[model samples]
Target chain A: MHYTEQSHTFRKIIMTKRITLADVAADAGVSAKTVSDVIHHRGRMREETRERVRNSMRALGYTTNLAARTLRTGSAKLIGLAIPNFAQPFNGNYADIVTSYAWAKGYRVSITTYHRLSQGLRELSADAYRFGVDGWIFLTDTPIPAQDNFLNQDRPVVLTGDYLSHGVADTIMFPNVEASQTATTRLFELGCERIGFIGAPANADSLDVTTQQLDAALTAQEGNSAMRLRGHLTALLQHNRSPLPSLVGACTRLDRSDGEKATLRLLDAGAQFDALFCANDAVALGAMSALTSRGLRIPEDVQIIGFDNTPDAAFSSPRLTTIDPFTEQYAQMAVDCLISRLEGDETAPTVHITDFALIERDSTRH
Target chain B: MHYTEQSHTFRKIIMTKRITLADVAADAGVSAKTVSDVIHHRGRMREETRERVRNSMRALGYTTNLAARTLRTGSAKLIGLAIPNFAQPFNGNYADIVTSYAWAKGYRVSITTYHRLSQGLRELSADAYRFGVDGWIFLTDTPIPAQDNFLNQDRPVVLTGDYLSHGVADTIMFPNVEASQTATTRLFELGCERIGFIGAPANADSLDVTTQQLDAALTAQEGNSAMRLRGHLTALLQHNRSPLPSLVGACTRLDRSDGEKATLRLLDAGAQFDALFCANDAVALGAMSALTSRGLRIPEDVQIIGFDNTPDAAFSSPRLTTIDPFTEQYAQMAVDCLISRLEGDETAPTVHITDFALIERDSTRH
Candidate 1:
């Protein structure tokens, strides 16, 4: 067999004949079972014998047959992380942290970004199974249905984000309602009334998930915007102020441009507000840009607060005062849950509600 | 054989007897060869037959042995992406773009973040081969040696970033020197003569990587910061303005906090400058934060410009004037190059010098 030499320091010797475990054992003068034990890191072996087997394997350029081993052990040592999108800085940061943590635990992560929110769960499960993923961590805005066969049965899954349904999988929920309430309360403490809300649904009533079935059917915007609005309204009600429908700006996406457009719409509509509560840092940044462009001073003209203390929140002009949803903690918890399940924990599906903190920066400082 | 019912919706059946291709063939009422062809998506089978075979396989819980097939085909259909770090937003965005593009091309990406700059290449190659990666896309600031065995012989690699060394891989250069030159020129055009730089090395002489050997031996800072500094100097020199060594703020990392500290360092050292050019958007954001904290107005006090036109640049207060280094285009080109190589386009290794555009925003506008 003619094998072309690759241009690397390690010469990739393409072989016509497959180098079997028996071949490696023969070269190392050991039994095939001993070679298997060494490969799997199963049984304890003499250091010299292990070294000899490893050396022989390297010499023969032996690559492990992962698929064959997976067939026997039903383990792939691969984790699939499905996110709605990566265009947002928060999602990207979340993925980075999750990947890093998973790597530390001797697992490799295959990231799949679902462009379509509605098809997210289906695509994530299909991709996960196709890639031979042992477990999955799905981060999505849309609520997953409990009847999802993949999430309910085949493999262990850990769901995260503002969505409500666990879909028969363990979930690590973000404290969106609590965080938003705290942010709005802080604005009121700063002497701001008639707070504007950006990145919320057009209808405030849609935020109510009174039943599990309704929660399962919740759209991404409905799930997140509703929770955040509820928080903002609760804060307003607590302050003896009625939630004004006119002050709410509906945004389809949680992006900076969306924030900008939503803020402009509110201003154009002549909505009266002394402060603004942006759904996320991206929206807050955009809102800040819009207000500054319109010659409105942050905290002076309109005190603004945001959610998800993304890296940009700390560096933005006026340095956005945002809610730290404990993203790292959320990611760690999701990973730990998935790992525990993979390690033979047959416990009932768990739901972890992550804690939040208000990161007071220059944007809302009096 | 008795089977234990798993906790999910789909009851996982543990079989005492292993199901084979012959079993699926018999169940589907097809020949074993037909079943094999259907599994591999080869040899042209009817749609009805294909569906039947697929159904039988699913019913019998037959999973394809990818490892066994990989041993025969010598292809894993996987690509490895090695980045310096994901903490920096630029690297995160780059990885996202690369992964998305790779997925569109029917290739899955395994991302590995190399924490240590010095051991980047060695670790990258080891990880790639260990995971049966067909190719690699490495984004690094460190200069790779020209005689790197991984690049010269093994799988094809496409290198991206400010580094000049291509080794045996194709290079997708970011045109850092030219972008920096243009940014500095823009500052001069705004009538600012004394320009301070954040994220450049303290020693200016290290910027000179005139020879291939020198380029190969260049440190991480020299590969990125030095090149950028050279561009700034070239622009200054073109306008008959001598580069002021004192005005340059040296930063160890291209991060927001580092940018802030570097700017403060320059100010404390009494290095007077009317304009600032940041290495990247993150640093520029930090510099902006520091300047604003000091009560200096953007453009009015110290005109500033940044590179990489990251998403934050558009949303930052005073909306950062930046050099759009064509990150998406660069990512696309790198993916294209790798895909071409994977498809057996064994032509001479190519070098792609990406173009840049100056995005004029509030930060540098008069």
Candidate 2:
């Protein structure tokens, strides 16, 4: 044999190509459709032939394209969700709950965080348009009125809580004001003489009108706010309690460090308050940590109440007595509403409100 | 006037619009271009005219579409990034670091999380394709294998540590095996005779390779791995050694309750162990909590070490000794690589490995 002929015969003998689906069908004396059906484990194949096909598929290396299958079904099975920030424990919990819920619904959630509330809302609206999210749930904190405009335009958007005003997007609102009022009232019912408030002043200024309303209803004081100082004094005087001095204001910052510093400032100022009501759990926890270091016994010397029943409340060394704002319920309801909107339910923006309950724990047992 | 005549007069009045830009220029005694410049806040406009134009805009409620302004400049000012399992603490930190970095660069990052690893990769790749992300940084638990044919097709992709195989996309990896070897060696230096190992089994298997290498380097009669019989033999041979056996097991199921139960089982089985080397901070914390509950003092009685120096590690009751895997560094590097690729850098895959350092805290110090 010539050299070229010898080389060609050697190449043919050495390179044994792997069997394809076509080869399997030809060898099995069946149509390519039958081979494909057997490969996919679709239907109606005899056991012996199924076994033969399965072995053949293994012998060959064939991978199915899931994307093609998904395209055929017209479902990408994905949902896009965004939140303001995840660094905060509460928002982290929110992201976690929404993700778990979305997963249970056979849809995957894509989560992104935005920092500035104004920017977050605009990005959310635009992202929903650019990214083909089945729907969107915005766990927002933007108090800007423009947030409403962007949300209204975003249509199929869900608002996690009363964090934003309604009539812009479908809203899931927690009874924040009601919860705060209830938390304040619980202290009074426990025979507390004087109560001081510690929270970020900036947050207090942006206080939702409903929260303002709840404060008004609870104390029977009507104005921009239910003056905690005035309420404490009125309660003291009306109940024939010992005459009290004006309430001392703690720093308005709501973070853990702020709470700690505020408590220290209150202590330093010689504020004769019997109970302390914190703006949120972080403030309460920080205050407790400070008080503990000062050798003060909680509920004996001072009763403390916190807002937002965070998961940390249960795990704290001395579990905190706080308000349960039902954020998860609000989130779930928001998802439901947004899904409806995405399904073409163009109902006028409606607000869903969930109630709050006071959870009495070791910290406030008088 | 009759109602129809009154309506016609009102419509005529409404149609009589305000002065146009030309009228503003003529009134202000400037060119139309100068008036337009003043209105748009162009740099060349005089400060006085700019103030006049600002006042006019406010009076007229002239709402500028910021999005349109960006389009005029051909910039969206947004980048879409995806990560797997943002709920995981490490991924959460990763997201925060990258978000801040992106913000510093004057770009907003739209984040999404995919729970299932491979599926997340596919969805993220698709998201990049459809959403027109300025760029993408794909953080995964595993490197994108070329054989993951769907992912190999195209798009700007960067892989982070966990899977460090060669011939893949631009990759960054943590030197986990190297770090584990160093951590293990440190334990030996600290006079820990019976070191128990616990972590995800696959991670433990990789550590086993490191331990084997260490044995060869040390040239000691002791084997890197301690089988039950081998542990018993070592204890029997060393006169002062406790009659306890070391264990290498899975950390996947190790939570607080599981730690308590597992410790009880090990204690009941009379397995003597002095030190535990955990896979992650969470497992280490659980193990430490169990040991202390059993009246065992850490380090003095049973030293503990963990991987992944998460924030909670330092704040842990008995601050866990953990390996700082440079997670932020890894995330930043991954972002840079993705940006470079987006900027049209076609360099071969560059592997960046971050060295791990042990943070000695309360748990590891007697």
Lowest lDDT 10-residue stretch of candidate 2 chain B: B6-15
Q: For each prediction, how big is the interface RMSD?
A: 5.9, 13.2
lDDT of 1 by residue, B96-136 (tens): 78777877887767666566323456555543434456778
lDDT of 2 by residue, A1-366 (tens): 112212321221111243456876765667888887875558797877766654443223222222222223424455667766655446666766676776666666666676643345554554443343556687665453542354544335776634544366677766655566566667888878677666523335532122343333345322112233334334444556543222333344355666777777777767777788776777777777667667787878788887778655654435679888776776677667766776679768887888778899977874
Report the Cα lDDT for residue A95, model 2. 69
Q: What ranges in model 1 sit over 4 Å off?
A: A1-37, A40-44, A51-76, A116-118, A129-132, A165-167, A202-222, B1-34, B41-44, B51-76, B116-121, B129-132, B147-149, B202-222
Which 10 successive residues of model 1 chain B have the least lDDT summed?
Answer: B1-10
lDDT tens per residue, model 2, B1-366: 112212221221111243366655554556778766764447586666666654443222222222223333433455666665544445566777777776766666766666543345554554442333555676655434444433342455666635543454677766665566566666766888787665433243532223343233232221112221132223333434333223544433334444444455555556677887766665666677667667788889988887778755654445678888888787778777777776689878777877668889877764
Listed models, DockQ each? 0.23, 0.11
> Model 1 Cα displacement at A218 (Å)?
13
Query: How high is the lDDT of residue B148 in model 1?
Result: 41
Q: How would you encode candidate 1's per-residue C-alpha lDDT over A71-155 as one tens digit per residue?
A: 4577757777777666778887887788888878877676666663234465445334345568788887766554443455366
